[model samples]
Target: MTMTAYLQTMERGDLDSWGTPEDIGSETVEGAPECAGSFDLGSPDDPVFGGLYSVTKGKYRVTYGFHEHATLLDGEVALTNEATGETVVYGPGDSWIIAKGTPVLWDIRSDVARKSYLAVTTDIPA
Candidate 1:
């Protein structure tokens, strides 16, 4: 197998780096976390992209506009589906997916949480 154009090599980037943790938007949720992430690949320019992202311990709600799959690289958390009230817990080594237009609640139960994720967006986020 070979790496493709979708691949990225990550390093510590300035606050202005694309997809860096600093690029954030808000929607309901709970507790504001002191967040940080260094981008490794992709950007708002691509139809599909990914990078490293993290959040401090806190309860929050997230709405997914794009299809995304992620691995829980660190920490423990609970995810609750908004429409069904179904909840699942995830810890290190766990992988999960959030479909486009779904809403989820993230209950971060560790000091910090991290994940590596890939997102496919039909409509790019600005």
Candidate 2:
């Protein structure tokens, strides 16, 4: 297969592999949530990668290690900024950018939530 650039549609069924329960580090705070992802563009260690992520019903905490721009593709999620204690609810079609090192609490509101994201491991230029 030739590796080339093409437009990829984000769908809920895009994820083909799933993480073990509570595999998202030691930050799991609530119900056991399993996450799955499939990279359509690049690998996780690449400077830039794009993929679809799906999480089962649960809540967890995460500290961003990379900058990510993502849009909710399915279900709902309440994201709280640990530093400011501010919460924002995101539904399908909503998009946001999270900076590296930002601590966030993720609460899945529906049975599951899916998002399509493009992440940058290096600094994003202004």
Regions of model 2 farther than 4 Å from truth: 1-11, 20-22
In the range 1-56, model 1's lDDT, one tens digit per residue, is: 43423222433233322232224553435665556654456774678887766777
lDDT of each: 0.69, 0.81
Stretches of model 1 off by over 4 angstroms after superposition: 1-23, 123-126
Who wins the TM-score comparison? 2
Say what the RMSD of model 1 is: 5.7
Q: Clash pairs of candidate 2?
A: none
Per lDDT, the best of the predicted structures is 2
Per-model TM values vs. the true structure:
0.74, 0.84
In candidate 2, what residue range of length 10 has the lowest lDDT sum?
4-13
